[model samples]
Target: MSILFQAYPLARAALFSMDAETAHEVTLSTLQRAYDCGVTRKLMHEQPETPTTLMGLTLRNPVGLAAGLDKNGAHIDALGNLGFGFVEVGTVTPRAQPGNPKPRIFRLPRAQALINRLGFNNLGLETFIANVQRSQWRQQGGILGLNIGKNADTPIERAADDYVLGLAGVYPHADYVTVNISSPNTKNLRALQGEDELAALLAQLRDKRAELADQHQRHVPLLVKIAPDLTDAQIDAIADLLPRHGIDGVIATNTTLSRDAVTGLPHAEEAGGLSGPPVHELSLGVIAKLRQRMGTDYPIIGVGGIVSGKQAREKIAAGANAVQVYTGLIYRGPALVSECVQAIRGM
Candidate 1:
């Protein structure tokens, strides 16, 4: 184990004492410094190569760092060194905008979860792509997924325009692109998941992908990220639409709007999406349903509330071809990545 991984318990204690977002920024900066000083090199020997292929891309392992942790695509090299098979960045928009007000991120220690209304707050496309372009992650044999979202100000009806724009901008650089219609923070963003809205959006994205694929001379698989708060019928409807629209795969979940598991905990009533242990079952349930509906061959990347090696294995058993993590990394640190990779490797 790396010294950093061994020190995480102590590091997490100090980070946990600060505001969630500030601690997040500090961690990123700290990672950059660690990378620059070659401290992250200590972690290299910790990675166990368990090559897995998903959506035509070969991953070093099935464990990935989920989107939203590095929203601007900055810190890709530092984060990739943490032992993820892939690192997905963004939930970025076409234009830059401040997200919701402060006190937006609350940590619930009792439940081991977080409530965040940070609302796709990112530095926008140009800067995001620039940062992505500067990264050596892909060159270093890591899969890179770029997650795109609509601007909060973008009218929900015209949302395709923003996604189409995002697709074009990131196509040349992405190993895969994720259309994030799942985040609960954006007003009416989830509305896009409705049958009619999703149909229209996918249709447009399909057409755009064809054009971009032809232009780039390479096809980048497009995937969709959905929320865990869906009904059985809603899941059925989405499963029916994905392949028809040329979506290469599905990311089983984002975060949840449900607080059922953490009803009495602090910040349980917070208005954003709930992640960590509280949403684990919900994410697993969604993945199982989607796998049942889409059949065994369809690709499904599971993510939500995975904080342990056993939970990562459960995601695979429940039908996730691969898995990703975010809140778990916040609570468990870099060691969680290798734990998950080792667990999934055994399967």
Candidate 2:
């Protein structure tokens, strides 16, 4: 634990010095190499206590490395060993494309947050699946969720096709799949969250899910990842739609465009989705609102701005059955995983 704590500042400094996008790549690459050399496997073996289950799938722990961190499924095995119960990869599109541009991701160290408009930049669906097929960490029994999205240039009118394509391609490999319409970087993508559009999209996806389950002789749960920036009315609409569309769960938030808590921070004005401490309360509010609308039985994976055991508990109390962490991991490191798990165990 002491060694892990000591590594935090050094890792932060090294990654902090580089451009945010470049630093993300560097960090994944470094982890991949460590994985290849058998280091990360050993870490997983050492962290054996970090395991839990949700949504009928067993997770190594409740805290997962969220989507966007390993968008292409490149580091699942390595990350699994890092003690995450699950590792969600990709806002993967049917076709790969370079996202926004350089300087698209910004760091707000003081706020322990990040603002990224990295518009689903990845090596496309085929490449992502190939990586997943070749992963050394297969059969770890940890939950693996593929987060699917439409390409940026894809028109919203035809966005359901992209999601269908993603569903068809990823259903066989994923423990579950997430439909990500919440990201702020994609142009007008969140408009899909509107009543008519969301209803249509989820209905089509559920139909596809039924088809795939029949074809593959299995059931793969479909989850929707929503944004923290929603109004109560918007969240309630989603809750009402979930059962009708056969959706299994909700990932209660991707990130927020709100800069409320980080108002005066260095990168406060950066144009992208804001995450970390600034989003904690707002995210909790969304979870609570969703729970109220959906009732106690609805499963929610609460994310955004979680940084401690107390915060994780707050999310559970608010309505989440499980939780995910990204910015919190960046700010607090792997020990936060164990802290959260221990806290949950106590509860």
Candidate 3:
């Protein structure tokens, strides 16, 4: 058995005893420390590697650690060591800012779910790039994705400026840069996904990317992260716009503001995007719809509510090029990474 699974119950017990956000911080810090100390390397069992290529980048596997787990890119190597085929960090802004107030993160243990309104909290792009540069993974040729977002205080009308700046800043560091327009916690950020707005925003970003690619002499793929609450009409619009806008891929979900899946559960009404098992069906449906609309080859990175190997496989069957885990990692620990890799490989 993998080391994380063998020791999960104990680690979970200790983690669960603390409040959700505290537990999250402690876990991240500990993982970073463990990884830095070379302790994780010893504890980890031999990982069977699986390679999959997507977006012109050859990943060691199809499983990846989604953004929000490491907003500042502080733990890339540690997470990379856990055997994810790729790792995405941040929803970082142009400047560091404390996100929404405390109690912003709530755990609904009964649902294996979490509601978080952290509004793109990170140590800004410079600090994020610093961490990225410090990672041994960068030199080792690991696949890394950088997720970018506007600061919460930035008005929706001027959001593109932040995105444009963020895109330019992170272009060199990212194997791909995910434009996070669907995070519900950010005020009207989801509005960017509207057909007209999305087209305009993407048009601007695309032009900027062309200039950057010429200057840097490398084209970093761009992907857009969308919300799960979208209707069929909205999903179809996004699919149509993706290729037109020169967008490389799309992450079918950010999270759901809908509590329909977790109604009556504690913290069910907590304000934020709901993630974990509760979002599984919703995210899967979006992936399926996007695949049907986008046709065979468009890359879709599936995420939301994936808590096991079976769910991970379901994502691919629905047409995801690869799958990412955020809440699944919180609920299942690092073992989820390998389990998902094996499951996807089995397919």
Candidate 4:
């Protein structure tokens, strides 16, 4: 086995032993330190290959660090040099708030999955935008996408205001912006997925996009991130609504609240969304549904349960223009990035 693969179990064990949130902070800090000391520069230079483009943005490769990993835009530069094609930061809300009490994040090592009810805990939109503005990676031409959301206390009816505010705040600095409407932790948030609500949200965002384009003299793509638990009817509604509202793309899934695959695991009953192997089929199904509804030409970014090159290929075949990895990155390490990129190249 490669050194990376060998080290993964040890690293995972160490991280898993700590409180999940604390371990996440420690990992981010370590990455930031490595980035500051130029360790990431050497790693990137010595790694497999150079850059590529996706969604009209220049990416160093196709392997992107998904949102929820760096909720507040911390570690963008650090993560960028770790060889991700792009980095998505935040499910940043309009206001900062402590998420659900302790034990919000759970791990099912046997299934290589994570369940997090992080409740959109973030540094808030202002801090998030400032961090992105100050990012060395953004200044250095790295592709960064901002994932935006409403404050936890914000009622579902007025969620569009939060999205619009976030979009406006991040527009000047982001390569593209993602509207995250799928997180299960937020009460009634997924209701936005309904045909009428989703149509209204997209229409509002499209109007904002036009205004931003005119104001900034550039067009920024707006991608909608959905939940894997949606029914065919809901997915069909989304597919039908997307083009009508000029939505740029679709992120096939967020995490799932179902525990279908890890039913007996110790933490399987946790009240957050589950991601990893258990989410594979559902996420793929969502991707396939979106692909069929939107057609091959529409861009679809598949995410969830992608632990290996083969899985990534399956997502591509299922019809993802690009794929994002989170839990898989936790289980597989940086090596999985190159592995999946190579796999996509072969395809």
Instruction: Report every candidate's CA lDDT.
Output: 0.93, 0.86, 0.89, 0.86
* lDDT preference between candidates 2 and 3, better one: 3
Candidate 3, residues 296-339: lDDT per residue as tens digits? 99999999988899999999999999999999898888888888
Q: Against the true structure, candidate 3 has what lDDT?
A: 0.89
* Winner by lDDT between candidate 4 and candidate 3: 3
**Candidate 3 Cα errors over 4 Å, as ranges:** 42-45
lDDT of 1 by residue, 1-347 (tens): 56678899999999999999999999999999999898885575468889898988999899998999999999999999888899999989999988999979999988889999999899999999999999998988889999999999989988999999999999999999999999999999999999989999999999999999999899999999999999998998999999999899999799898888998887889899999988999999999999999999999999999999999999999999999999999989998999999899888
- Decide which is better by TM-score, 2 or 3: 3
- Compose the digit string of candidate 2's lDDT tens values, residues 1-347: 45755687889787888888787788778877977886656666555465555777877667777898888898889777777777788989999999998788898887888998888999999999998887755476768899999999999999999999999999999999999999999999999999899999998998899999999999998999999888778887999998789899999888898887888888789888998878889889999998888888878999988889888888888888888888888778777877777777677
Stretches of candidate 2 off by over 4 Å are: 1-5, 48-51
Candidate 2 least-lDDT 10 residues? 44-53
Clashes of 3: 1
1 or 4: which has the higher TM-score? Answer: 1
- State the lDDT at 9 in candidate 4: 77
RMSD of each: 0.9, 1.5, 1.3, 1.7
Q: What lDDT is reached at residue 304 by model 1?
A: 94
